[model samples]
Target: MNSPELQNVPLFAFATAMEFSKVFPEDSSKAESQNQLIPLSGPFQGCFACILGVGILDFSAGLASLLFNCKQTNFKISAVISLGICGAYPDRGLSLLDVVNVSSDRVGDLGCEEQDGSHTLWDKSILGGNCCQAPAVIQKMLVALPQVVGATVNCCTGTATTAVERVKNMGCDVESMEGAACFAICQKFNIPAFQIRAVSNIASTRDKSQWKIEEALEKLHKCICG
Candidate 1:
């Protein structure tokens, strides 16, 4: 079948579990136990739709694919975005409140071990390859945000050293849990997509006290709204 002609493209933004909780307070009446959609008005004008409760790896991937498959006004989504908080490696020069534009993503932890003890998971080339490029419209929209940085990685870097090594290896500016999955889904559907992340903490030793989650989430709201 032919792709539907959409007047306005729908933007799908995904946030982490904690950020989602803050953005959409739990409603007991809703049987799902998690808030899924947070509608916006005014400047967003309903064109921008946020998908919360997408913290789980498989769930997030499935949800994004499901949305893409759903019969909206058009067959293909105008754009898909994952806006949330991520861990930044200090060596990469990213500080809290800095936004990261994901140029690429990969399953950092999904690989098999070789006889030489080297592990290999899906790489950026395998996920979308050179053919996977960010949408021009999304890039234009991001140019207005000066603090935005760019990054790519295959797995989540939770430790300082691991974060640093991955940054050095992949040349990415930040780390998160689900961008690769989002990228994979978009690529599979031939849909245009982008990922923007606000740095909430240093990708160092586990330390919750250092995270600026609330501030990052607020910044994310503003960025997407803008």
Candidate 2:
């Protein structure tokens, strides 16, 4: 299948194949690369779709994969859209499968381990803040969606103590493995970016039964389509 035209083509980047399928299952056409698909209808109509599945859930991996895809596109990407699922903090009062427009993302594990074995946050004084801001225009467009501040890490917080510590240290309302990396890459390329996440589970505990993967994916699809 032929790729979407270079101009006005939104790069919808998914972190996994499952996530990609949720958005473009039926109309996805095989292109030059399995990771790349030409989407002809639905929310992805006339859009460039890419799956960053190799990374699984790691910040560095996300960063590398995103940059590589950007290079391969050979086009001035219109916008970088990182769309997937994330774990919401319990204190945020968000329900399962609620879509979130990530207003900002902080790299939660960017600092050193202290002598007391607690993690110390990186100094963001130079940049003036810890959180990486999302595009203002995207934020305006997503005003109807729930907005969340997210923290990205290599691993999700699985225990109560760690969860509390994470919130205290990072001041984030949700957690994901790739949001911050997506933001950074977009900033470097001077492209506007948006990280939209659907809540799949509570970050406080490691309970798969409590997760809503399908519902979250559906919400993600609907939010994007609208």
True-structure RMSD, every candidate: 5.1, 4.5
Measured by lDDT, the strongest candidate is 2
Q: Name the regions of candidate 1 deviating beyond 4 angstroms.
A: 1-7, 16-39, 48-56, 71-76, 113-118, 125-141, 145-156
TM-score for each predicted model, relative to the true structure: 0.72, 0.81
Q: Model 2 reaches what TM-score against the true structure?
A: 0.81
For residues 142-169, write the lDDT of model 1, one tens digit per residue.
Answer: 6544433333343455677776655565
Residue 170's lDDT in candidate 2: 72
Worst 10 residues of 2 by lDDT: 123-132
